[model samples]
Target: MTQTSNISRRRRTKQAKGGADYEAKRAELLRIAAELFKEQGFQSTRLLDIAQAAGLDRATVYYYVGSKEELFHETVEGVLDANIAVAQQLIEDDSLRAIERLKKIFVSLMISYEDNYPATFVYIQEQMHQVAADETAWAQDIMKKTRQFDQILIGFIGDAIAQGDLRGDIPVRLVENALFGMLNWTHRWFVPGKGMTGQQVAESFWSIFIGGMVPARADA
Candidate 1:
């Protein structure tokens, strides 16, 4: 290659690597900020704390995330994004029966909670406070994301009912709410080494949910 061409190629490579490095740093900052926000509450967590956690100066943290509230939003967005992706994948997979698919969804959700405990904790606490304080915008945003999950559950339940695998009399909304209550609350007491993997927990849930919700033969 000519000297000029080689220099240009090296410059392009350097820029590409720099872009990747920036993204990595941004993600690290968001993760650290999320942990701090979860532990201390978003309003109480200082930029300095996030900076210290991320091994960066406060100014650098601000440069990446802009502000504490923005960081919190980014953190929540990251978790929700992961959740949406998982739900989409579950909905798309056709190999499993509806009940089996439901089980996998629960398992994936529990694993997500376990993996992002800090963010989950922070989100829950913030949501409660938002509702209590009548922070309309925040509450609405939270509710919107919640409704997304509810809709996914409703669709699954609807499918199962159509397949004669679930009871049709139960309202989709009610079933969705009950299922979410059971699955989401596992983060409170679920311990990894306590003789139950996420799949095992999901199986137990399936026993109760499927047995109770499935239509009787006489009803068919």
Candidate 2:
């Protein structure tokens, strides 16, 4: 290759490597920040704290992310997208019974919490309040996305009731809110070695749901 062509090739190669490295590093930084946010609330976390947790200096972090606020938003969005994407997939599975899909949604989320810090989800949910109190349109967008999952879940519960599984007397919206209330509080007490696996905890809790909603045996 001519000298100018050689220079162009070298520049392209360098840019490609830099882009790949940035992606990898960005993921690492987000992981550390997420865990830290879970350990401490978003307001309590600092940029330096994230850098130290990620084993990087402040300058490197700033090079990748403009500010802690930006990083927090990215991290929260990452967790929210990952979580709902999975639930959406399950909700859309036509082959699975709606009730089973419902159970799977709970089980899958418990696994996510078991793997990712439970606070990742709590962070996004708690942001709903902060954004709402500020009267920002951003909260409306967030809620719009959030209600997608709620609508899907409400449909699932309604299907179960229609199938004579859940009680018809109970409102679908009420059951939906109550189920989330249980899941949302898991962050407060769920821990890795607390004498139960994530799946076990999910199954146990889901059993309560099943018992309460499912019709009692005619003989009993």
User: Tens-digit lDDT track for model 1 on 1-220?
Assistant: 4754555565455546678677788778777877787678788888888888888886555445556777667667677778878888888888877766666777788777667766676777565446445556765776677678767867877887788787888887788778778876775677556777767777688788877886777656
Candidate 2: residue pairs that collide = none
Each prediction's RMSD over C-alphas, in Å, is 7.9, 6.4
Please identify model 2 stretches exceeding 4 Å from their true place. Answer: 1-20, 118-128, 134-138, 217-220
lDDT of 2 at 11: 47
| Per-model TM-score versus the true fold | 0.75, 0.79
For residue 49, model 1's alpha carbon misses the true position, in angstroms, by: 1.5
Q: Whole-model Cα lDDT per candidate?
A: 0.72, 0.73
Best by TM-score: 2
Those runs of model 1 whose alpha carbons end farther than 4 Å from true positions after fitting are 1-18, 128-145, 191-195, 218-220
**Candidate 2 per-residue C-alpha lDDT over 1-220 given as tens digits, one digit per residue, 9 for 90 to 100:** 4754555565455546787777788778777776777678777889999999888887656666756766666765555577789877876688988888788887877777777654455464456468545545645655666777777778888988888878888888898877766777776677767888888988888988787887766798
Q: Candidate 2 at 82: error in angstroms? A: 2.6
